[model samples]
Target: MDSKNKQQNDQKKSTKSNGNSKSQSNQTKSTSSTKKQKQARFGEEHEGKLLEFFVEEVKDIYFAEHEALKALKKMEKAATSKALKDSIVQHHGETEEQIKRLEQVFELLGEKPSKKKCEGILGIIKDGESVIEDTDDNTMVRDAAIIIASQKIEHYEITSYGSLAELARTLGKDDLAELLEVTLEEEKQTDVTLTILAEESINEDASNE
Candidate 1:
Protein backbone atom coordinates (compact mmCIF):
# COMPACT_ATOMS: atom_id res chain seq x y z
CA MET A 1 0.00 0.00 0.00
CA ASP A 2 2.86 2.36 0.85
CA SER A 3 4.52 1.71 -2.55
CA LYS A 4 1.20 2.21 -4.36
CA ASN A 5 0.62 5.54 -2.56
CA LYS A 6 4.14 6.65 -3.44
CA GLN A 7 3.59 5.82 -7.14
CA GLN A 8 0.31 7.82 -7.20
CA ASN A 9 2.04 10.84 -5.68
CA ASP A 10 4.77 10.72 -8.37
CA GLN A 11 2.15 10.62 -11.15
CA LYS A 12 0.41 13.71 -9.75
CA LYS A 13 3.74 15.55 -9.60
CA SER A 14 4.55 14.71 -13.22
CA THR A 15 1.19 16.03 -14.44
CA LYS A 16 1.68 19.29 -12.51
CA SER A 17 5.15 19.74 -13.97
CA ASN A 18 3.80 19.29 -17.54
CA GLY A 19 1.04 21.81 -16.95
CA ASN A 20 3.52 24.43 -15.67
CA SER A 21 5.82 23.89 -18.63
CA LYS A 22 3.01 24.33 -21.14
CA SER A 23 1.82 27.52 -19.44
CA GLN A 24 5.35 28.99 -19.53
CA SER A 25 5.73 28.12 -23.18
CA ASN A 26 2.44 29.83 -24.05
CA GLN A 27 3.43 32.96 -22.10
CA THR A 28 6.76 33.20 -23.93
CA LYS A 29 5.08 32.97 -27.34
CA SER A 30 2.60 35.66 -26.36
CA THR A 31 5.36 37.98 -25.24
CA SER A 32 7.37 37.44 -28.41
CA SER A 33 4.38 38.11 -30.65
CA THR A 34 3.62 41.33 -28.77
CA LYS A 35 7.21 42.46 -29.23
CA LYS A 36 7.06 41.78 -32.97
CA GLN A 37 3.87 43.82 -33.32
CA LYS A 38 5.41 46.74 -31.49
CA GLN A 39 8.44 46.65 -33.74
CA ALA A 40 6.31 46.62 -36.87
CA ARG A 41 4.25 49.57 -35.61
CA PHE A 42 7.39 51.57 -34.89
CA GLY A 43 8.72 50.96 -38.39
CA GLU A 44 5.43 52.02 -39.94
CA GLU A 45 5.35 55.19 -37.88
CA HIS A 46 8.83 56.16 -38.96
CA GLU A 47 8.03 55.61 -42.62
CA GLY A 48 4.82 57.59 -42.21
CA LYS A 49 6.74 60.63 -40.97
CA LEU A 50 9.20 60.60 -43.87
CA LEU A 51 6.38 60.34 -46.39
CA GLU A 52 4.54 63.18 -44.65
CA PHE A 53 7.54 65.48 -44.92
CA PHE A 54 7.99 64.73 -48.62
CA VAL A 55 4.32 65.39 -49.29
CA GLU A 56 4.43 68.70 -47.46
CA GLU A 57 7.40 69.91 -49.49
CA VAL A 58 5.58 69.03 -52.68
CA LYS A 59 2.51 70.93 -51.50
CA ASP A 60 4.55 74.03 -50.76
CA ILE A 61 5.92 74.18 -54.30
CA TYR A 62 2.54 73.37 -55.76
CA PHE A 63 1.12 76.40 -54.05
CA ALA A 64 4.04 78.53 -55.15
CA GLU A 65 3.58 77.57 -58.78
CA HIS A 66 -0.08 78.56 -58.71
CA GLU A 67 0.81 81.83 -57.03
CA ALA A 68 3.37 82.44 -59.73
CA LEU A 69 0.81 81.72 -62.43
CA LYS A 70 -1.42 84.46 -61.08
CA ALA A 71 1.45 86.85 -60.47
CA LEU A 72 2.81 86.32 -63.98
CA LYS A 73 -0.42 87.63 -65.46
CA LYS A 74 -0.26 90.73 -63.35
CA MET A 75 3.43 91.27 -64.12
CA GLU A 76 2.78 90.92 -67.82
CA LYS A 77 0.20 93.66 -67.60
CA ALA A 78 2.45 95.83 -65.45
CA ALA A 79 5.46 95.44 -67.76
CA THR A 80 6.19 98.32 -70.13
CA SER A 81 8.72 96.56 -72.37
CA LYS A 82 7.08 94.62 -75.20
CA ALA A 83 9.85 92.08 -75.06
CA LEU A 84 9.44 91.64 -71.32
CA LYS A 85 5.71 91.21 -71.66
CA ASP A 86 6.18 88.46 -74.25
CA SER A 87 8.70 86.70 -72.03
CA ILE A 88 6.22 86.81 -69.20
CA VAL A 89 3.64 85.10 -71.36
CA GLN A 90 6.19 82.51 -72.40
CA HIS A 91 6.89 81.82 -68.77
CA HIS A 92 3.16 81.43 -68.25
CA GLY A 93 3.21 78.51 -70.66
CA GLU A 94 6.21 77.03 -68.86
CA THR A 95 4.38 77.38 -65.56
CA GLU A 96 1.55 75.32 -66.94
CA GLU A 97 3.96 72.52 -67.83
CA GLN A 98 5.70 72.77 -64.48
CA ILE A 99 2.43 72.36 -62.63
CA LYS A 100 1.63 69.29 -64.70
CA ARG A 101 5.03 67.82 -63.97
CA LEU A 102 4.44 68.31 -60.28
CA GLU A 103 1.17 66.48 -60.62
CA GLN A 104 2.98 63.60 -62.27
CA VAL A 105 5.40 63.50 -59.40
CA PHE A 106 2.52 63.19 -56.98
CA GLU A 107 1.16 60.27 -58.96
CA LEU A 108 4.50 58.50 -58.88
CA LEU A 109 4.51 58.74 -55.13
CA GLY A 110 0.96 57.40 -54.96
CA GLU A 111 -0.34 60.62 -53.50
CA LYS A 112 -2.75 63.25 -54.67
CA PRO A 113 -1.31 66.48 -55.98
CA SER A 114 -2.00 69.11 -53.38
CA LYS A 115 -0.98 72.57 -52.16
CA LYS A 116 -0.57 74.49 -48.97
CA LYS A 117 -0.65 78.23 -48.49
CA CYS A 118 2.83 79.38 -49.43
CA GLU A 119 3.51 82.54 -47.48
CA GLY A 120 6.84 83.14 -49.19
CA ILE A 121 5.35 83.15 -52.68
CA LEU A 122 2.44 85.24 -51.48
CA GLY A 123 4.83 87.79 -50.05
CA ILE A 124 6.76 87.94 -53.31
CA ILE A 125 3.53 88.38 -55.25
CA LYS A 126 2.41 91.14 -52.92
CA ASP A 127 5.77 92.78 -53.28
CA GLY A 128 5.39 92.68 -57.04
CA GLU A 129 1.88 94.10 -56.74
CA SER A 130 3.11 96.96 -54.60
CA VAL A 131 5.91 97.72 -57.01
CA ILE A 132 3.39 97.91 -59.83
CA GLU A 133 1.15 100.19 -57.79
CA ASP A 134 3.98 102.42 -56.66
CA THR A 135 5.54 102.87 -60.08
CA ASP A 136 3.99 104.93 -62.86
CA ASP A 137 2.02 102.92 -65.37
CA ASN A 138 3.64 102.14 -68.77
CA THR A 139 7.10 102.97 -67.46
CA MET A 140 10.42 101.13 -67.74
CA VAL A 141 10.65 101.29 -63.92
CA ARG A 142 7.79 98.83 -63.69
CA ASP A 143 9.48 96.57 -66.17
CA ALA A 144 12.57 96.53 -64.03
CA ALA A 145 10.44 95.84 -60.99
CA ILE A 146 8.67 92.95 -62.71
CA ILE A 147 11.94 91.44 -63.83
CA ILE A 148 13.43 91.61 -60.35
CA ALA A 149 10.32 90.15 -58.77
CA SER A 150 10.18 87.30 -61.29
CA GLN A 151 13.82 86.51 -60.62
CA LYS A 152 13.12 86.24 -56.92
CA ILE A 153 10.36 83.77 -57.62
CA GLU A 154 12.63 81.76 -59.90
CA HIS A 155 15.38 81.62 -57.30
CA TYR A 156 12.94 80.39 -54.70
CA GLU A 157 11.79 77.70 -57.11
CA ILE A 158 15.32 76.63 -57.90
CA THR A 159 16.16 76.20 -54.25
CA SER A 160 12.94 74.41 -53.47
CA TYR A 161 13.23 71.98 -56.39
CA GLY A 162 16.89 71.33 -55.71
CA SER A 163 16.21 70.38 -52.13
CA LEU A 164 13.18 68.31 -53.04
CA ALA A 165 15.06 66.45 -55.76
CA GLU A 166 17.87 65.69 -53.37
CA LEU A 167 15.39 64.41 -50.85
CA ALA A 168 13.76 62.22 -53.47
CA ARG A 169 17.11 60.75 -54.36
CA THR A 170 17.87 60.09 -50.74
CA LEU A 171 14.56 58.37 -50.37
CA GLY A 172 15.38 56.15 -53.34
CA LYS A 173 12.79 57.79 -55.57
CA ASP A 174 14.88 58.09 -58.71
CA ASP A 175 11.92 58.82 -60.94
CA LEU A 176 10.76 61.67 -58.76
CA ALA A 177 14.27 63.04 -58.52
CA GLU A 178 14.55 63.08 -62.29
CA LEU A 179 11.29 64.97 -62.72
CA LEU A 180 12.18 67.54 -60.09
CA GLU A 181 15.63 68.02 -61.56
CA VAL A 182 14.04 68.88 -64.88
CA THR A 183 11.94 71.50 -63.21
CA LEU A 184 14.98 72.76 -61.32
CA GLU A 185 16.87 73.27 -64.56
CA GLU A 186 13.95 75.19 -65.96
CA GLU A 187 13.88 77.44 -62.95
CA LYS A 188 17.60 78.10 -63.29
CA GLN A 189 17.15 78.93 -66.94
CA THR A 190 14.32 81.30 -66.17
CA ASP A 191 16.45 83.05 -63.57
CA VAL A 192 19.23 83.48 -66.08
CA THR A 193 16.81 84.77 -68.66
CA LEU A 194 15.49 87.33 -66.25
CA THR A 195 19.00 88.45 -65.43
CA ILE A 196 19.81 88.83 -69.09
CA LEU A 197 16.64 90.75 -69.72
CA ALA A 198 17.50 93.07 -66.89
CA GLU A 199 21.11 93.56 -68.00
CA GLU A 200 20.64 93.84 -71.77
CA SER A 201 18.04 96.60 -71.76
CA ILE A 202 15.56 96.78 -68.89
CA ASN A 203 17.94 97.97 -66.21
CA GLU A 204 19.75 100.37 -68.51
CA ASP A 205 16.46 101.74 -69.76
CA ALA A 206 15.28 102.23 -66.19
CA SER A 207 18.49 104.05 -65.32
CA ASN A 208 17.96 106.40 -68.27
CA GLU A 209 14.42 107.07 -67.15
Candidate 2:
Protein backbone atom coordinates (compact mmCIF):
# COMPACT_ATOMS: atom_id res chain seq x y z
CA MET A 1 0.00 0.00 0.00
CA ASP A 2 2.84 2.44 0.95
CA SER A 3 4.72 1.67 -2.28
CA LYS A 4 1.59 2.26 -4.37
CA ASN A 5 0.96 5.56 -2.59
CA LYS A 6 4.55 6.67 -3.25
CA GLN A 7 4.27 5.79 -6.98
CA GLN A 8 1.03 7.80 -7.28
CA ASN A 9 2.61 10.76 -5.49
CA ASP A 10 5.68 10.65 -7.77
CA GLN A 11 3.52 10.54 -10.89
CA LYS A 12 1.43 13.46 -9.66
CA LYS A 13 4.56 15.51 -9.00
CA SER A 14 5.98 14.69 -12.45
CA THR A 15 2.74 15.69 -14.19
CA LYS A 16 2.62 18.95 -12.26
CA SER A 17 6.20 19.72 -13.31
CA ASN A 18 5.39 19.07 -16.95
CA GLY A 19 2.29 21.25 -16.72
CA ASN A 20 4.30 24.13 -15.24
CA SER A 21 6.95 23.81 -17.96
CA LYS A 22 4.32 23.95 -20.71
CA SER A 23 2.65 26.92 -19.09
CA GLN A 24 5.95 28.82 -18.94
CA SER A 25 6.66 28.04 -22.60
CA ASN A 26 3.29 29.42 -23.62
CA GLN A 27 3.82 32.54 -21.54
CA THR A 28 7.16 33.17 -23.21
CA LYS A 29 5.58 32.75 -26.64
CA SER A 30 2.80 35.14 -25.69
CA THR A 31 5.32 37.74 -24.58
CA SER A 32 7.18 37.43 -27.86
CA SER A 33 3.95 37.76 -29.83
CA THR A 34 3.03 40.85 -27.86
CA LYS A 35 6.36 42.46 -28.64
CA LYS A 36 5.87 41.87 -32.37
CA GLN A 37 2.35 43.29 -32.22
CA LYS A 38 3.67 46.44 -30.56
CA GLN A 39 6.27 46.81 -33.27
CA ALA A 40 3.57 46.48 -35.94
CA ARG A 41 1.47 49.04 -34.16
CA PHE A 42 4.42 51.40 -34.16
CA GLY A 43 4.43 51.27 -37.94
CA GLU A 44 0.69 51.83 -38.31
CA GLU A 45 0.57 54.75 -35.92
CA HIS A 46 0.17 58.26 -37.36
CA GLU A 47 3.29 60.21 -38.09
CA GLY A 48 4.41 62.68 -35.50
CA LYS A 49 7.20 65.24 -35.77
CA LEU A 50 10.06 62.70 -35.81
CA LEU A 51 8.33 60.73 -38.53
CA GLU A 52 7.77 63.96 -40.46
CA PHE A 53 11.45 64.74 -40.21
CA PHE A 54 12.25 61.17 -41.22
CA VAL A 55 10.04 61.36 -44.29
CA GLU A 56 11.53 64.71 -45.26
CA GLU A 57 15.00 63.21 -45.15
CA VAL A 58 13.82 60.25 -47.22
CA LYS A 59 12.49 62.66 -49.82
CA ASP A 60 15.86 64.32 -49.95
CA ILE A 61 17.53 60.98 -50.74
CA TYR A 62 14.75 60.10 -53.16
CA PHE A 63 15.28 63.32 -55.07
CA ALA A 64 19.03 62.86 -54.96
CA GLU A 65 18.79 59.37 -56.48
CA HIS A 66 16.84 60.69 -59.47
CA GLU A 67 19.30 63.51 -60.02
CA ALA A 68 22.22 61.11 -59.59
CA LEU A 69 20.81 58.91 -62.34
CA LYS A 70 20.93 61.78 -64.81
CA ALA A 71 24.40 62.78 -63.68
CA LEU A 72 25.65 59.19 -64.11
CA LYS A 73 24.33 59.03 -67.67
CA LYS A 74 26.04 62.29 -68.59
CA MET A 75 29.20 61.16 -66.80
CA GLU A 76 29.12 57.89 -68.73
CA LYS A 77 29.24 59.90 -71.92
CA ALA A 78 31.96 62.11 -70.55
CA ALA A 79 34.17 59.14 -69.59
CA THR A 80 36.98 58.36 -71.99
CA SER A 81 37.88 55.11 -70.25
CA LYS A 82 35.66 52.22 -71.29
CA ALA A 83 36.00 50.74 -67.81
CA LEU A 84 34.73 53.93 -66.13
CA LYS A 85 31.83 54.24 -68.53
CA ASP A 86 30.78 50.68 -67.83
CA SER A 87 30.91 51.33 -64.09
CA ILE A 88 28.69 54.38 -64.44
CA VAL A 89 26.24 52.43 -66.57
CA GLN A 90 25.99 49.68 -63.98
CA HIS A 91 25.42 52.19 -61.18
CA HIS A 92 22.72 53.93 -63.16
CA GLY A 93 20.69 50.72 -63.06
CA GLU A 94 21.35 50.34 -59.34
CA THR A 95 20.14 53.91 -58.79
CA GLU A 96 16.94 53.02 -60.57
CA GLU A 97 16.44 50.14 -58.18
CA GLN A 98 17.17 52.45 -55.27
CA ILE A 99 14.42 54.77 -56.45
CA LYS A 100 11.94 51.91 -56.49
CA ARG A 101 12.97 50.93 -52.99
CA LEU A 102 12.38 54.49 -51.83
CA GLU A 103 8.91 54.33 -53.31
CA GLN A 104 8.24 51.18 -51.34
CA VAL A 105 9.42 52.98 -48.23
CA PHE A 106 6.83 55.63 -48.94
CA GLU A 107 4.20 52.94 -49.26
CA LEU A 108 5.24 51.59 -45.91
CA LEU A 109 4.65 54.99 -44.34
CA GLY A 110 1.20 55.20 -45.95
CA GLU A 111 2.23 58.29 -47.85
CA LYS A 112 2.57 59.06 -51.51
CA PRO A 113 6.13 59.82 -52.49
CA SER A 114 6.98 63.51 -52.54
CA LYS A 115 10.16 65.43 -53.20
CA LYS A 116 12.02 67.91 -51.07
CA LYS A 117 14.47 69.99 -53.05
CA CYS A 118 17.91 68.52 -52.49
CA GLU A 119 20.22 71.43 -53.14
CA GLY A 120 23.22 69.29 -52.27
CA ILE A 121 22.55 66.84 -55.09
CA LEU A 122 21.75 69.74 -57.39
CA GLY A 123 25.15 71.29 -56.61
CA ILE A 124 26.99 68.00 -57.21
CA ILE A 125 25.19 67.48 -60.51
CA LYS A 126 26.24 70.95 -61.60
CA ASP A 127 29.82 70.18 -60.64
CA GLY A 128 29.72 66.97 -62.71
CA GLU A 129 28.29 68.88 -65.65
CA SER A 130 30.97 71.55 -65.37
CA VAL A 131 33.70 68.88 -65.34
CA ILE A 132 32.33 67.40 -68.55
CA GLU A 133 32.05 70.78 -70.24
CA ASP A 134 35.55 71.87 -69.18
CA THR A 135 37.34 68.66 -70.24
CA ASP A 136 37.65 67.32 -73.76
CA ASP A 137 35.71 64.01 -73.81
CA ASN A 138 38.42 62.04 -75.61
CA THR A 139 41.20 62.88 -73.14
CA MET A 140 42.53 60.84 -70.18
CA VAL A 141 41.98 63.97 -68.12
CA ARG A 142 38.29 63.61 -68.83
CA ASP A 143 38.31 60.07 -67.44
CA ALA A 144 40.05 61.28 -64.31
CA ALA A 145 37.57 64.12 -64.00
CA ILE A 146 34.65 61.73 -64.39
CA ILE A 147 36.07 59.49 -61.66
CA ILE A 148 36.35 62.47 -59.35
CA ALA A 149 32.82 63.58 -60.12
CA SER A 150 31.42 60.09 -59.69
CA GLN A 151 33.18 59.52 -56.39
CA LYS A 152 31.90 62.81 -55.03
CA ILE A 153 28.33 61.69 -55.79
CA GLU A 154 29.01 58.29 -54.25
CA HIS A 155 30.28 59.87 -51.02
CA TYR A 156 27.21 62.06 -50.80
CA GLU A 157 25.00 59.01 -51.24
CA ILE A 158 26.93 57.07 -48.63
CA THR A 159 26.41 59.83 -46.07
CA SER A 160 22.73 60.20 -46.93
CA TYR A 161 21.98 56.48 -46.82
CA GLY A 162 23.86 56.00 -43.56
CA SER A 163 21.90 58.79 -41.90
CA LEU A 164 18.60 57.52 -43.29
CA ALA A 165 19.25 53.99 -42.11
CA GLU A 166 20.12 55.19 -38.64
CA LEU A 167 16.99 57.27 -38.50
CA ALA A 168 14.81 54.42 -39.76
CA ARG A 169 16.10 52.05 -37.10
CA THR A 170 15.57 54.66 -34.40
CA LEU A 171 11.94 54.93 -35.43
CA GLY A 172 11.54 51.11 -35.27
CA LYS A 173 11.42 50.86 -39.04
CA ASP A 174 13.82 47.94 -39.47
CA ASP A 175 12.47 46.97 -42.88
CA LEU A 176 13.07 50.45 -44.27
CA ALA A 177 16.43 50.68 -42.54
CA GLU A 178 17.61 47.45 -44.15
CA LEU A 179 16.77 48.80 -47.59
CA LEU A 180 18.79 51.95 -46.95
CA GLU A 181 21.64 49.88 -45.59
CA VAL A 182 21.79 47.92 -48.81
CA THR A 183 22.16 51.16 -50.78
CA LEU A 184 24.74 52.44 -48.34
CA GLU A 185 26.91 49.37 -48.88
CA GLU A 186 26.57 49.76 -52.63
CA GLU A 187 27.64 53.37 -52.49
CA LYS A 188 30.69 52.47 -50.42
CA GLN A 189 31.57 49.69 -52.89
CA THR A 190 31.20 52.07 -55.84
CA ASP A 191 33.51 54.57 -54.18
CA VAL A 192 36.09 51.82 -53.69
CA THR A 193 35.75 50.81 -57.35
CA LEU A 194 36.20 54.41 -58.51
CA THR A 195 39.31 54.73 -56.35
CA ILE A 196 40.76 51.56 -57.84
CA LEU A 197 40.12 52.71 -61.42
CA ALA A 198 41.81 56.01 -60.69
CA GLU A 199 44.78 54.60 -58.80
CA GLU A 200 45.45 51.76 -61.23
CA SER A 201 45.70 53.82 -64.44
CA ILE A 202 43.36 56.73 -65.01
CA ASN A 203 44.98 59.21 -62.63
CA GLU A 204 48.52 58.31 -63.69
CA ASP A 205 47.59 58.46 -67.34
CA ALA A 206 45.99 61.85 -66.84
CA SER A 207 49.02 63.17 -64.95
CA ASN A 208 51.32 62.05 -67.80
CA GLU A 209 49.21 64.17 -70.13
Candidate 3:
Protein backbone atom coordinates (compact mmCIF):
# COMPACT_ATOMS: atom_id res chain seq x y z
CA MET A 1 0.00 0.00 0.00
CA ASP A 2 2.88 2.43 0.79
CA SER A 3 4.58 1.55 -2.56
CA LYS A 4 1.34 2.29 -4.45
CA ASN A 5 1.04 5.64 -2.63
CA LYS A 6 4.64 6.51 -3.63
CA GLN A 7 3.90 5.57 -7.29
CA GLN A 8 0.88 7.95 -7.30
CA ASN A 9 3.09 10.73 -5.90
CA ASP A 10 5.70 10.19 -8.66
CA GLN A 11 2.97 10.29 -11.31
CA LYS A 12 1.64 13.57 -9.94
CA LYS A 13 5.14 15.12 -9.95
CA SER A 14 5.67 14.14 -13.63
CA THR A 15 2.31 15.63 -14.58
CA LYS A 16 3.15 18.89 -12.85
CA SER A 17 6.52 19.14 -14.61
CA ASN A 18 4.85 18.53 -18.02
CA GLY A 19 2.35 21.34 -17.35
CA ASN A 20 5.12 23.76 -16.43
CA SER A 21 7.05 22.89 -19.61
CA LYS A 22 3.97 23.56 -21.76
CA SER A 23 3.45 26.93 -20.06
CA GLN A 24 7.03 27.97 -20.74
CA SER A 25 6.69 26.93 -24.39
CA ASN A 26 3.56 29.06 -24.75
CA GLN A 27 5.28 32.08 -23.19
CA THR A 28 8.18 31.80 -25.57
CA LYS A 29 5.83 31.72 -28.57
CA SER A 30 4.02 34.82 -27.33
CA THR A 31 7.29 36.71 -26.93
CA SER A 32 8.35 35.79 -30.46
CA SER A 33 5.04 37.00 -31.86
CA THR A 34 5.42 40.34 -30.08
CA LYS A 35 8.92 40.81 -31.48
CA LYS A 36 7.70 40.11 -35.03
CA GLN A 37 4.97 42.72 -34.66
CA LYS A 38 7.46 45.31 -33.48
CA GLN A 39 9.77 44.56 -36.41
CA ALA A 40 6.92 44.92 -38.92
CA ARG A 41 6.03 48.32 -37.48
CA PHE A 42 9.63 49.45 -37.64
CA GLY A 43 9.95 48.36 -41.29
CA GLU A 44 6.87 50.36 -42.25
CA GLU A 45 8.27 53.45 -40.58
CA HIS A 46 11.62 53.03 -42.31
CA GLU A 47 9.91 52.65 -45.70
CA GLY A 48 8.17 56.01 -45.23
CA LYS A 49 11.48 57.78 -44.62
CA LEU A 50 13.06 56.04 -47.62
CA LEU A 51 10.35 57.32 -49.92
CA GLU A 52 10.90 60.89 -48.72
CA PHE A 53 14.62 60.50 -49.24
CA PHE A 54 14.04 59.46 -52.87
CA VAL A 55 11.96 62.57 -53.51
CA GLU A 56 14.81 64.74 -52.30
CA GLU A 57 17.24 62.66 -54.29
CA VAL A 58 15.20 63.30 -57.45
CA LYS A 59 15.51 67.03 -56.85
CA ASP A 60 19.25 66.62 -56.62
CA ILE A 61 19.23 64.55 -59.83
CA TYR A 62 17.56 67.48 -61.55
CA PHE A 63 20.61 69.63 -60.97
CA ALA A 64 23.00 66.76 -61.58
CA GLU A 65 21.76 66.33 -65.15
CA HIS A 66 22.08 70.01 -65.76
CA GLU A 67 25.71 69.84 -64.72
CA ALA A 68 26.14 66.73 -66.85
CA LEU A 69 25.19 68.64 -69.97
CA LYS A 70 28.05 71.06 -69.43
CA ALA A 71 30.51 68.23 -69.01
CA LEU A 72 29.09 66.39 -72.01
CA LYS A 73 29.76 69.36 -74.26
CA LYS A 74 33.40 69.26 -73.19
CA MET A 75 33.44 65.54 -73.85
CA GLU A 76 32.12 66.09 -77.32
CA LYS A 77 35.08 68.31 -78.04
CA ALA A 78 37.53 65.83 -76.62
CA ALA A 79 36.10 62.83 -78.48
CA THR A 80 38.19 61.64 -81.42
CA SER A 81 35.78 59.12 -82.91
CA LYS A 82 33.05 60.51 -85.14
CA ALA A 83 30.45 58.10 -83.82
CA LEU A 84 31.38 58.82 -80.23
CA LYS A 85 31.25 62.55 -80.89
CA ASP A 86 27.86 62.22 -82.53
CA SER A 87 26.57 60.14 -79.65
CA ILE A 88 27.71 62.75 -77.14
CA VAL A 89 26.08 65.53 -79.15
CA GLN A 90 22.84 63.57 -79.43
CA HIS A 91 22.87 62.86 -75.72
CA HIS A 92 23.37 66.53 -75.02
CA GLY A 93 20.05 67.21 -76.70
CA GLU A 94 18.49 64.31 -74.83
CA THR A 95 19.88 65.66 -71.59
CA GLU A 96 18.19 68.98 -72.31
CA GLU A 97 14.89 67.20 -72.82
CA GLN A 98 15.47 65.34 -69.57
CA ILE A 99 15.93 68.65 -67.79
CA LYS A 100 12.71 69.95 -69.28
CA ARG A 101 10.92 66.86 -68.01
CA LEU A 102 12.32 67.49 -64.56
CA GLU A 103 11.07 71.07 -64.72
CA GLN A 104 7.64 69.82 -65.71
CA VAL A 105 7.73 67.49 -62.73
CA PHE A 106 8.61 70.48 -60.53
CA GLU A 107 5.74 72.46 -61.97
CA LEU A 108 3.42 69.57 -61.38
CA LEU A 109 4.47 69.66 -57.75
CA GLY A 110 3.80 73.42 -57.64
CA GLU A 111 7.47 74.03 -57.16
CA LYS A 112 10.20 75.75 -59.13
CA PRO A 113 13.41 74.25 -60.42
CA SER A 114 16.04 74.75 -57.75
CA LYS A 115 19.76 74.09 -57.68
CA LYS A 116 21.34 71.73 -55.24
CA LYS A 117 24.87 70.43 -55.57
CA CYS A 118 24.87 66.74 -56.27
CA GLU A 119 28.20 65.57 -54.98
CA GLY A 120 27.82 62.25 -56.75
CA ILE A 121 27.39 63.73 -60.22
CA LEU A 122 30.01 66.32 -59.45
CA GLY A 123 32.49 63.61 -58.63
CA ILE A 124 31.63 61.72 -61.82
CA ILE A 125 32.07 64.81 -63.99
CA LYS A 126 35.33 65.66 -62.28
CA ASP A 127 36.56 62.15 -62.99
CA GLY A 128 35.59 62.60 -66.61
CA GLU A 129 37.57 65.81 -66.72
CA SER A 130 40.61 64.02 -65.40
CA VAL A 131 40.18 61.33 -68.00
CA ILE A 132 39.93 63.93 -70.74
CA GLU A 133 42.88 66.03 -69.57
CA ASP A 134 45.32 63.36 -68.47
CA THR A 135 44.73 60.69 -71.09
CA ASP A 136 46.47 61.04 -74.41
CA ASP A 137 43.84 62.33 -76.80
CA ASN A 138 44.43 59.34 -79.09
CA THR A 139 41.36 58.00 -80.87
CA MET A 140 41.32 54.66 -79.07
CA VAL A 141 42.15 56.00 -75.61
CA ARG A 142 39.57 58.77 -75.85
CA ASP A 143 36.82 56.42 -77.03
CA ALA A 144 37.59 53.95 -74.24
CA ALA A 145 37.47 56.65 -71.60
CA ILE A 146 34.35 58.18 -73.09
CA ILE A 147 32.63 54.80 -72.97
CA ILE A 148 33.47 54.46 -69.26
CA ALA A 149 32.43 58.03 -68.42
CA SER A 150 29.18 58.10 -70.40
CA GLN A 151 28.08 54.74 -69.02
CA LYS A 152 28.72 55.92 -65.47
CA ILE A 153 26.51 58.97 -65.98
CA GLU A 154 23.77 56.92 -67.61
CA HIS A 155 23.73 54.41 -64.76
CA TYR A 156 23.48 57.13 -62.18
CA GLU A 157 20.59 58.85 -63.96
CA ILE A 158 18.78 55.56 -64.40
CA THR A 159 19.01 54.79 -60.68
CA SER A 160 17.82 58.26 -59.73
CA TYR A 161 14.86 58.20 -62.11
CA GLY A 162 13.81 54.71 -61.02
CA SER A 163 13.90 55.66 -57.36
CA LEU A 164 11.97 58.85 -58.04
CA ALA A 165 9.32 56.88 -59.89
CA GLU A 166 8.89 54.58 -56.90
CA LEU A 167 8.64 57.53 -54.56
CA ALA A 168 6.07 59.25 -56.73
CA ARG A 169 3.96 56.11 -56.80
CA THR A 170 4.18 55.78 -53.03
CA LEU A 171 3.02 59.40 -52.75
CA GLY A 172 0.05 58.68 -55.08
CA LYS A 173 1.41 60.82 -57.89
CA ASP A 174 0.62 58.34 -60.64
CA ASP A 175 1.12 60.72 -63.54
CA LEU A 176 4.42 61.96 -62.21
CA ALA A 177 5.50 58.40 -61.57
CA GLU A 178 4.69 57.48 -65.14
CA LEU A 179 6.70 60.39 -66.47
CA LEU A 180 9.69 59.44 -64.36
CA GLU A 181 9.33 55.82 -65.40
CA VAL A 182 9.48 56.76 -69.06
CA THR A 183 12.64 58.77 -68.46
CA LEU A 184 14.12 55.89 -66.53
CA GLU A 185 13.44 53.56 -69.40
CA GLU A 186 15.06 55.94 -71.83
CA GLU A 187 18.16 56.24 -69.68
CA LYS A 188 18.44 52.48 -69.45
CA GLN A 189 18.12 52.19 -73.21
CA THR A 190 20.78 54.79 -73.69
CA ASP A 191 23.10 52.85 -71.43
CA VAL A 192 22.41 49.73 -73.42
CA THR A 193 23.11 51.54 -76.68
CA LEU A 194 26.41 52.73 -75.30
CA THR A 195 27.31 49.22 -74.34
CA ILE A 196 26.47 47.96 -77.77
CA LEU A 197 28.48 50.69 -79.43
CA ALA A 198 31.42 50.01 -77.18
CA GLU A 199 31.32 46.30 -77.78
CA GLU A 200 30.68 46.40 -81.53
CA SER A 201 33.14 49.13 -82.33
CA ILE A 202 34.71 51.06 -79.45
CA ASN A 203 36.54 48.31 -77.60
CA GLU A 204 37.70 46.53 -80.72
CA ASP A 205 39.16 49.73 -82.14
CA ALA A 206 40.60 50.73 -78.79
CA SER A 207 42.29 47.37 -78.45
CA ASN A 208 43.85 47.59 -81.93
CA GLU A 209 45.91 50.48 -80.60
Off by over 4 Å in 3: 1-55
lDDT of 3 by residue, 1-209 (tens): 25698578656655655576777757755765686588669877977787557557767998899898998888888888888888888888888998998888888877778767888999988997888787778577788898799888888898889878888887778988998988898788888888888999988988888
Q: In order, what lDDT does every prediction score?
A: 0.87, 0.85, 0.82
| Candidate 1 residue lDDT tens string, 43-153 | 779767887898899999999999999999989878898999989999999999999999999999898988999888899889878878898988888898888889888
TM-score of each: 0.79, 0.76, 0.74
Give the candidate order by descending lDDT. 1, 2, 3
User: In terms of lDDT, which candidate is strongest?
Assistant: 1
- State the displacement of the C-alpha of residue 148, model 3, in Å, after optimal TM-score superposition: 0.3
Q: List the residue pairs that clash in candidate 1.
A: none
lDDT of 2 by residue, 122-143 (tens): 9988997897789885899999
Instruction: Give all candidate RMSDs, comma-separated.
Output: 13.5, 11.1, 12.1
